[model samples]
Target: MVRLEKDLLGEREVPATVYYGIHTMRALENFPLTEYKVSPVLIKAIALIKKTAAEVNFELGYLTKEKGQAIAQAADEILNGQWQDQFVVDALQGGAGTSTNMNVNEVLANRAIELLGGQKGNYSLVHPLNDVNMHQSTNDVYPTALRIAAIWLLKPLSEGCAALQEALQAKEAAFAGVIKVGRTEMQDAVPIMLGQEFSAYAGAIARDRWRLHKVEERLRQAALGGTAIGTGINANKKYIFMVNDRVRQYAGIGLARAENMIDVIQNADVFVEVSGLLKALAVNLGKISHDLRLLSSGPRAGLRELRLPERQAGSSIMPGKVNPIIPEAVNQTAFHIMASDMAITMAAQSGQLELNAFMPLIAHHLLGSLKILTNAVHILDEFCVQGLTADEEHCRNLLENSQVSVTALVPHIGYDLASKVARRASEENITIRAAALALAVLPAEKLDAILDPRAMTRPGIAGTPK
Candidate 1:
């Protein structure tokens, strides 16, 4: 039996097939450089797919021992990381991962042939399609590999979010008693503890984490047995169950059979759901980055309540300047994820009756979102959060200058008098205490008691209830 390369050559010499031929070797040369190049995530996914496929073929019971062994050997080489060099297809392409699947088949088949003491592409002995890809279709395999990939990504993403939550929780605990001005529409309206603000960011991330996990659960329903459509038309019934079970075991994921294989085959809602989760994460990160930029704005003019780490030099000419480069990077990543989301939305919407057929874009965008969010979260946590400091002096100055102090006066001086004092404080650039003193709305000692920003920040003890 001769390999595809040997058959194409017609002699012992290897043939120069198209850069990335329909087979695995072509996939390698064609996709020699790509962001979608094989990752451990893809390796594990392909391993699961191949293992499941082999189990299915075995259950079909049509092949002899040698043929089954050939398929198994090729899959083992992949699982053992021997063919890492061959998986080069760009995941961003529109082939719906057909080239990627074929890459796996060709490389594995060629490796299997070598193991069997034959030249590569020896289809008569062990064909890539006949022996290796016995009962699988790209439609089923692509989505299944996606689920496997998502499962791989979910662990670190969740853990990274948890780490961020912990960092925020620590910030909350660290700043719990430290009061600062809380602004509405960029104007101070009330007082809240610095810790409360950090805790709120953490809470937002926590909820997003729960939402993403729920999204991942929807990803568990795969279209593996659906083949070209929901019918599983050419596949053996025993093959379906065996492959499903084996893939589940091999991947260590709880991928159950789809109840409506037609719906699974036709729709790309699962990708949509995952994309939505990623968008949520990106939105949250954007908000967090925006807040960081705002909080760290000025050591002289703006609200300098919080200080992010000085990631890089702020200006080319300005010495003693540090910029929030990490937060800026976070913002950019969020924008990229948002753009990816638009692609996912379009792909999801463009699906025809039977199949979306735009899954390549879905995978590309969703996977890009996952990768970006993961790395951004890491940078935010490691460089930004780890070195963050609350500017106690800035917090004090903000609270001291805040007209929100007059919130306590609403109980003692009444709404009308308090509004007058607040207006005076704002228009005249005077402290609310001084404004109250000038207005004779309250005595100096009484005004101090009623308008203390610290008391207002504490809650439930700012003033007597009127």
Candidate 2:
């Protein structure tokens, strides 16, 4: 290990292993790994983080071209793919992203140092803090990274919504002409096409996509140069624009500085708002999942208009049983996202003056919720919706068995007679069609035409023969 002098700030002495690509080791030694690591989104957000810091460092007259090229090259590699597989770090520990920010600097600097034909730990040639970090502090960098990470992570959310929309569209088209019972309070009330239910589900996902897109607009505002407080202080004026420009370029995004540093640095309500959007998305997912679970309950005893993919054995004792496991996963993810939103709200409220020290928890829970919901959406799309089946016979049987068909007799035999028919059908366990025939509520041919599920599915038709 090459020996290095202590920092001019008179902080702890630099370790040699940190200079040699041992980012994890240095992170553990310098900042406690704790339970939470950095978020993958934040890790990816480093391109913006480094771009902002590098320009500022260069403007501060501390960075040389040779070191700059090295850092830039390493950053490019990270942006491309080299470090994509290592983001499973716990997100529950560390304050101010000390461990995470330093990990990026150390790893990138080591890789850049190697590219410069210099041995690792040879700050004599390139220094992670002095050259790579320059005029930046973890305070400014962490929040900036979080914003970029949230933007990066929104991709999956968008795609998940699209997939759900497609699923609903497909189901809508497939069941367009298939009629079924529409229920209110679990009792038959009217008629609607199975396609109408799927269309509603599809419409819900489209609305969710819109909400997420709106939330992302607010999330794009980041505090890049607030630097330890609401003031840029020692940072150069042009450095902010340059870093933000480069970060946007690298991230393929439209990131911008906060309009007001005082408000941005002091308040984390934007994060809370974004978290709430995620919770809203989770609620949508839970609603759709619950609907699917209800629609696919059983082949024999329950409403079986639809069928989910049989992922695992649903019952321990029953044979050939299948359950809506994908929907269940979606349900759990929704709960987690809601809880994460609460954490974000609390953290945003916990700020004292200009900084929220509880940001670590906010980032941790929000990122976790994003990842969990992302995977859940994908799983539901791939392993469940893609494989769903419709029970044609069961749907027809339910429609035929419902007593709501007695309403067709209202205009023919009058309301009082229709009520008698419905009550008699319910009491005798006979279908409304059978009771109508026994009571001579309407001619058999007229009853058959008017009580048809397809005829009832049309609007403005009160189950009367036309």
The best candidate by lDDT is 1
Stretches off by above 4 angstroms in model 1 are 1-40, 458-461
TM-scores of all candidate predictions against the true structure = 0.90, 0.86
lDDT of candidate model 1 versus the reference: 0.76
User: What tens digits encode model 1's per-residue C-alpha lDDT throughout 1-466?
Assistant: 2213533434342343321224544444555555656455665576568756765676578666666776776777677766675666666554567777777776666666677887664557777777777777877887778777877787678778888888888898998878888988987788888888998899989987788766667878766767876778777778777787777777777888888878887788777778778888889989999999999898778788888877778899999888888989999999998898888999888989877777767777777678778899999989998788998877887788777788888877689988999899889999988888889987787776666666676557565553
Give the Cα error of residue 285 in candidate 2, in Å: 1.8
Model 2: CA > 4 A from native: 1-36, 55-61, 83-90, 117-119, 122-124, 312-319, 407-418, 437-449, 463-466
- The residue-by-residue lDDT of candidate 2 on 430-463, one tens digit each, is 9888888888766788777777767776665554
What is residue 154's positional error in candidate 1, in angstroms? 1.3
RMSD of 1: 3.5
- Per-residue error for 122 in candidate 1, Å, reads 1.9
Q: Lowest summed lDDT over 10 consecutive residues: which window, candidate 2? A: 2-11
lDDT of 1 at 59: 54
Native-structure RMSD, model 2: 3.6
